[model samples]
Target chain A: MTALPPKLQDYLDDFSFITTREERADFLIDIADSFQPVPARVASKPYDEAHRVIGCESEAFVWAVERADGRLDYYFDVLNPQGLSAMAMSAILDEACSGAPLEQVANISGDVVFAFFGRDISMGKGRGLTELINAVVYHARQRL
Target chain B: MSDIKSRGYANADKLVSTDWVAAHLNDTGVRIIESNEDPLLYPSGHLPGAVEVDWVKDLNDPLRRDYLDRAGFEALAGRIGISPETTVIFYGDKSNWWATYALWVFELFGHTNAKIMDGGRLKWAEEGRELTREKPDIGPTSYTAPERDDSQVRAFRDGVLAHIEAGGQLVDVRSPGEFSGETLHMPGYPQEGAVRGGHIPGASSVPWSRAANEDGTFKNAAELRAIYLDEIGLNPEEPTIAYCRIGERSSHTWFVLTNLLGFGDVRNYDGSWTEWGNSVGLPIEK
Candidate 1:
């Protein structure tokens, strides 16, 4: 469970139009109770500063979050696609962090979801893109 | 992007790039399905984790021909390891022509999640993406097909004849030579068919090649909208049927009109030229 800010919480309460509304309501109840921001570290310098990096546009950031049971999940977040800000990426993370029960809804492996999100960003379609963003926001508001 | 540019994507973005798919080569959840004709292409080399599905052998109803019946499709999906939950991405060479047809078949049975990889293997290999010879381990999964969406598919001969008689706009996406009965590509085809060895009455020739660039990626929204709206004068609201040789190329246009362009009532005449060109006693025009 993750604790969500009040503003996000209010947004979830008013969210509609997504199928399976009650699941979202249940998801909201769990996360609003308890959640925290996992610490993420971006490299001090861009790829040009890293002698070992060889790609054209390369940068790396890692996220470490402490679970309720004191377990830690560590992952490397790579920013490859241009115009996709770290803030937008974090917004997606915040949705997942807020207690979406992602495993229950689709069990999409985190890496697969991450890659899918990256591809979606590359395409620039607001159809499924915004829906996914709204899904996260809605989940965060209800659960975290 | 302007509305014209945005509108061009109607079928253009219905594809995923090989470079994009290659980046996720190791993803176990992303299953790739190849609906191709040649056995050499299927087993010899394909994108990593791709399962070959033959349209004639795996998809078509052997008893009925061309049309895929519910039972056959159900078994085919199971054989290809497609589940209701699977995000099935399909692709094939030649402008993703066959792949879009596969997408139509899947969507007709309610698998809207099925997306065609644009540019197909041609672009993928051109970009130096990875391909594999070893087949992935196959799994059996049950697929519950929803009722077929008849509104989006049609048989070639029947569709064209009906359109000619009914005055509906039949858009032929074949080459001008094929439409004029000058240079037929497919072997064992009769030469004395299709009204007068040409397109149906009231039909317009919009070659499938016009839909995409040489790289196989689609023309942007403005470009496609110009061709479909300004150039061809197709209204997005009206009923339109697209057809080409063997129903393959037409699926490309079908993908553009319905999926990318957001036209609701577009159907692909699957029997296409094979059925239309060989039919007895139809009006022919060069």
Candidate 2:
């Protein structure tokens, strides 16, 4: 385990502002509002090549950039019409892990990410969070 | 999709047009409920008079593995500004998937006055309808809870198994791959899926999408009849139970069978494959 990256720490800092499930959900919505969609070509690739995120409610793909400083940068593409929450989760990971140390990204736990939902999110939604975290961790570890 | 009225539903009033909603935007007795597959859609922009009702938050019981208790149902209705006499019109995205899901819950609480918007949000947008970011602040009212009637339209796992045991008609309203055990859940929605795949024994595979046109509105009665009554050979007089993963999609078929075609006995097995696939010793059809 490594020291928590500043950006990941910043996300945890902001987590205090989200007390209600709606607020936590709204935070993800805000992430969706700022998310960029994948290019047409990249989106059409096969799952293996697309780096598909298994276990999401939608087809999500990730690409990580390992910088000279040993930090990881992430870009995500989610292929589901109703996958706003997954996109938001990708955006959160993008901010938290991108440019952060690889060790920090690898160490970030799924539980802590969904703690935003305050133990009240649906069982299905809880799995969605875990899947997203698992995707991020899988990508980070592979890069590591 | 053609005019929904052409199909001649037993209660055609259950399907209202976007124009009807527009005309009744400020009408006190009509409470517009918007529940979407994507929870964030309401905040982005929605029908001016609609209040958001989440399937998970408002419909489910907090502690139990079931829907809200009798008092909780009444409180939820009142909290959402719905009274007994109010006509609840539902509409949302993903072809009104969550909208139908919410309407089914309303039916569980015996709110027969409920309705669905024809073509849902897609058709509304396709027809150049208006959307606003304004959220309505309607006053809460006293909504009396109807008696908990789980028998009429909802089917638990036990009832589903018994129906199978008794050689009853069961519709597995899931995708072909899921019915074949090739996929666990809808592509991307992995969380709602069970540990294993395949459907209950003796259940016919008729994906819920077959009941709807491409735009997400219900197909005409003739098309649905060809699928359900003719193709699947289900008798309208006998009871039919429909199930999907976690029960949302099946409600679409439940709405189609019970309301559209006038089937007197159709129940939505809400626990669905998630429950069935997890239970050990439960026979898996595939």
Best by DockQ: 2
lDDT of each: 0.58, 0.80
The TM-score of the first chain in every model comes to 0.28, 0.81
| Residue-wise C-alpha lDDT for candidate 2, range B1-286, written one tens digit per residue | 5566777677687898888899999898999988876666677678888899988778888778898888988888888898888899999876777889899988878888999998788778777778876778878888888778897889987888889999999999988989988888764455345887898999999988888778878887788888999998999999999998889999999999988888989999999998998988888978
- List each candidate's DockQ score: 0.01, 0.32
**Model 2, which residues run further than 4 Å from truth?**
A38-59, A65-72, A78-82, A123-130, B7-10, B125-128, B181-197, B277-283
Error of 2 at A93 (Å): 2.2
Candidate 1 residue lDDT tens string, B1-286: 1222344465444556666577666666667887643223444468888887655556566676555767767888788787877777898755676687788878777777777776676667767777776778888778778666666565456665776788776788887877776755322223333433566667788898797877666667667778887888888887888987667679889888887777867888877766766678776666
How many residue pairs clash in all the candidates, one count each? 27, 4
Q: How would you encode candidate 1's per-residue C-alpha lDDT over A1-144 as one tens digit per residue? A: 444444334443434333442343233334322323233352333433322211112132434344575333333333432112322333434554443343332322223222322222211122223333333343333333
> Which window of ten consecutive residues has the lowest lDDT sum in model 2 chain B?
B184-193
